[model samples]
Target: MSRVAVLMGGRSLERQVSLKSGARAEDALERLGHEVLPIDAGPDLVERLSTLAPDVAFIALHGRDGEDGTVQELLDVLGIPYTGSRVSACISCADKVLAKHVLRDRGIPTPDWHAFSETAFRELGAAQALPAIEERLAFPLVVKPAGQGSALGIKFARTAADVPMALVSAFSYDRKVLLERYVPGRDLAVSVLEDADGEPRALPIVEAVPNEEDFYDFEARYEIGRTRFVCPAELDDELTGRASELAVAAYRALGCEGFARIDLMLHADGGELDVLEANVVPGLTETSLLPQAAEAAGISFDALIARVLELALNRA
Candidate 1:
C-alpha cells in the first residue's frame, strides 16, 4: 500500500461534483488497502501537497485550474506523479475549441464549430455577427464556453432570437464561446484506459439517456437517476466497433495518458458518429459514466481505483 492523495473540491464551477468524486475515490482507495488522504484543492494547493507528500496524487478535480493543466503544471514542478494525462495533454483537452482542432487535424470526425471571444461579440454587435453565424451553421446550434465541463454554460438555440441570450450565458463562464451545429442523435461516452501492458484500450461504450431533460446537462450528469447509462450501448457490432475505434483514436490524438472519457453523438440514422469532447479527468461520482463503463467490464470500483494508481506509478 502506498500513500495516495485524492485531490478534489477545487475553486471551479464543478467543485461540488469534484467533492463527490473525490469522496468516492478516497473510499475506493482505502478499501484497496492504501493510505488515502483527501485534500480539498485551493489557492494553497501547493502548500497542501507539500504538507502531505504522497506516492501519487489521484486528481478528482474538474474544470478551471484542475482540468486546464494549471494543477498538473504545479504537480510537475513539485515532482508528484498524478493520475490522468500529463500537462500538455490536459491543456489540449481542456479547451473545447482546441480539442476540436486536434481531432479534426487527426482525421477524427467532430462537429464543425465557430469560436469567438466575448470582446469580439460585444464589439461586432449581434446584428452583424448573428447573420454570419446563421448562414454558416444554421438554426439549432449549441452555444457553450470553450473551456468548461459538465455541460456548464451550455445553451441550445433553435432560432435567431435565442442567440443573444445563449451567447451572454456562455460568455459569462468563459471569455471564448463556441457555437457548433447541434446534431440530433444518441449521447454515447467511451472510456479509454492504459492497460497493464501500457497500451491504450477502449472500454465498453455507455449510452446516456436523459430522463426528462432535452440534453445531458449538468443536472442529468450529477443528479442521481436523472440519466440512465446503458453500457456496451445498444449498438450493433459494426457501430460499436467503429465508436470504440474512434474513441481510442481521439485519446491517442490528444496524447492522453492514464485515462480519459470521450463523448460522441451517434446520429439518428446510425450512419455517422461525431466526436463531441474529450474529458481528461472524467467525473467518478456514482452517476459518472466512466465508472459505469468499468463496472460493466467486470472491474469493481476498488479494483479500478487500484488499477489507476498502478498506471500512475508505472508512468512515474
Candidate 2:
C-alpha cells in the first residue's frame, strides 16, 4: 500500500477512454489498499503532482500528452516513478510512424507504409505523389493519424479516390498521417509483461473479431459486444510461439519497460504476421484487451495491477 497517483483524463482525443482506464486503475489501487489520488491531466498536472507528492504514478492515460513522453518526462522531473514504459519508449510507441521505423530497423516484421505531414501536403505539394505511393502500396490502404490512439482517427481507403478524404480526416487529428498496406486478416493483440528475470514475456494473444464484416474501428473496439475477442487466438502451437516471440522482440526493440501491448495483423492469405504498432499505456477498462489477455494467461485483473505497481516500485 503506497501513495499512488492515477493519471487520466487528458485533453487528448482519447480523453474518454483514458478516463475509463484511470478510473479502473484507481479502483484496483483502492482494492489493493493503496492511497489513490486521481488526477485529470491538464495545465495543472505538474502542480497537482507536486502538491500531492505521490510515491508513484500509475498512468492510465492514452494518446497525445499521455503517451507521447510529455507526462512521463514531467513525472521524471518530479522524481515520481511511474508504471509502464519510460519516456523514450513512450515517445517511440506514441508515434505510429516512428514505432514502425523502429520495428523495421530492428529487423522486425511490420507492414509496408508511408507517412506524410500536413505541411508536406499543403506547402510542399506532397499530394501530387499520391499516385506513386498508391501504386506501390496498392489499394485498400489504412490511413490513420500518426500519434492518436484508441483508433481515434483511423480510416480505410478502398480505392485511389478514397485516399484524399482519408488523409484529410487523419490530418485533422494529427499533423502527420500514416498510410499502411491493409492486411485482410485477423486482428491480433499481444500484451507483454516482464518475467521474474526482467525478460519480457508475451501474454496470451487476443484476436479481435468484429461481429460485422467490417474494419475494427474505435467504436467496434471500445463498445462491448461490437467485437468478440478470442483469447489465445485459436492459433496452432507453432504459430502461437512465433507470434509470442515476435511480440517480445517488438517490446524489447521499443525499449518498453514494465508492460506494453503490441498490435499485429495475421494475413488471411499466407498467415504472414506483421506488427502495426505498440501501445505503451494500453487500456485497462472492462472491455480492454490487455486484461483479457492477462486473464487468459491465468492472471486476474487485481493481480495484474499489483504486478504493474510492483514493477514501477522497482525503480526505487
Candidate 3:
C-alpha cells in the first residue's frame, strides 16, 4: 500500500474534534493495509511532512488553519496529494458568505441572508446597523461567524433584543458575520463523492435530530449520542431525489473534488429545500454523517477510506 499521513489537531477551536477524526481515519487506513503515519498538525506541520514524506495525506483537520485552505495550499506547494477539495474550493466553501453567493449565482436555492464585517458594524454602530439588519432579515434569524464550521459561533435570535449579543458572539470568532432567515424544518445532510471514473455521485440523505438542542451546535455534533441520524432519511422518494440532486449541484458549483457534505433544510411544509452551506472536508469521526451515509450505501468504513485515498492519488 501507499504511505499515508493522517493530519490532525491543528491550532483551531476544533482541534479536539480533528484529533478524533484523525485517529479514526488512521485506524481505517491501517485496516485497509496502508502504511499510515499519524501527524498532529501544528505550526511545524510543513517541517514534519517534509520529514515523513508520505505518498498521500489524509486531512482530518477541521476549521481555521485546516479547513480554510491554508493547509491545502501548503500541501499543494509540497506536491503532496491529499484527500478532499483543492485550495480554491476549500477557500470558497469555508466562507459561508462566499459560498452562498456562489450557490445563488449557480441558480441554487440557498436561504436569503445578509453579511456584515466588524468594521462596518462598528462604524455604523449597533443602533443604525441593528435596525438595518432586522429590516433585511426579520426575527427568527440565524446568526453565525461567516468562516466557522461545526455550528461554532452560531446563535438564534427570535427578536431584535437578541441580535446585538448574537453579533458580538459571532464577531468574536470572525470579523464577518452572516444573518440568515431561519428556515423551520428538517435538518438534512447529503454526502457527495466522486467515483473511480471521476463522476460525482450523491450518497444517502441523512436527517439530523438533535437530542437536546434546538440546533445542531458543536456540542450536539461531537458529543456522543447527542444527535440521532436517520440515514436514507425518512424523506419520500421525490424529496430524497431532489435533495441528492441539490447536494450534487452545490458540490459542483463549489468545484469540490473527492467528497463534500451539503447541509440543507427541508421546510416544515415538506416541500421547499434551502441550501445552508457546503463542507469541503466533512467530519470523519464516528458521529459524522458521511460515514453513516456510506454505510447505508453498502460501503464499509475501511472501503470508504480506501476509495477517498484512491481519489486523492488520481486527482489532477
Q: Which candidate tops TM-score?
A: 2
Give the poorly placed runs of model 3, Cα more than 4 Å off.
Answer: 124-127, 212-226
By lDDT: ranked, best first: 2, 3, 1
Better of 1 and 2 by lDDT: 2
What does the lDDT come to for candidate 1? Answer: 0.88
- Per-residue accuracy of model 1 over 1-316 as CA lDDT, tens digit each: 8999999998988999899999999999988889998989977889989988888999999988888899999999999999989999899999999999999998999988889887785787644867887879987898989986777788888888998898889888889989999888898999998888779889999998778754625445546677788887998899999999999999999999888999999988747999999999898988788898988989877777888889999889
Per-candidate total of colliding backbone pairs: 0, 0, 0
lDDT of 3 by residue, 1-316 (tens): 9999999998888898899989999999988899999998877799989999989999999888778899999999998999999999999999999999999999999989989899886787645766776887787898999996777788888888888898899999999998999888888999998888878999999998777764624445546677788998998899889999999999999999999999999998748998999988788888788999999999888888988999999873
**What lDDT does each candidate get?**
0.88, 0.89, 0.88
Worst 10 residues of 1 by lDDT: 213-222
TM-scores for every predicted model: 0.94, 0.96, 0.95
Give per-residue CA lDDT, model 2, range 1-316, as digits (tens): 7999999999987899899999998998999999999999989999999999999999999888888899999999999999989999999998889999999999999989989999998899999999999999998888999985777779888899998888988888889999998888888999998865567899999998888765735456556677888997999998899899999999999999989999999889987899999999998988888999999889988888998999889866
Whole-model alpha-carbon lDDT for candidate 3:
0.88
Clashes of 3: 0
Indicate the residue-level lDDT of 277 in model 3: 92
Better of 1 and 2 by TM-score: 2
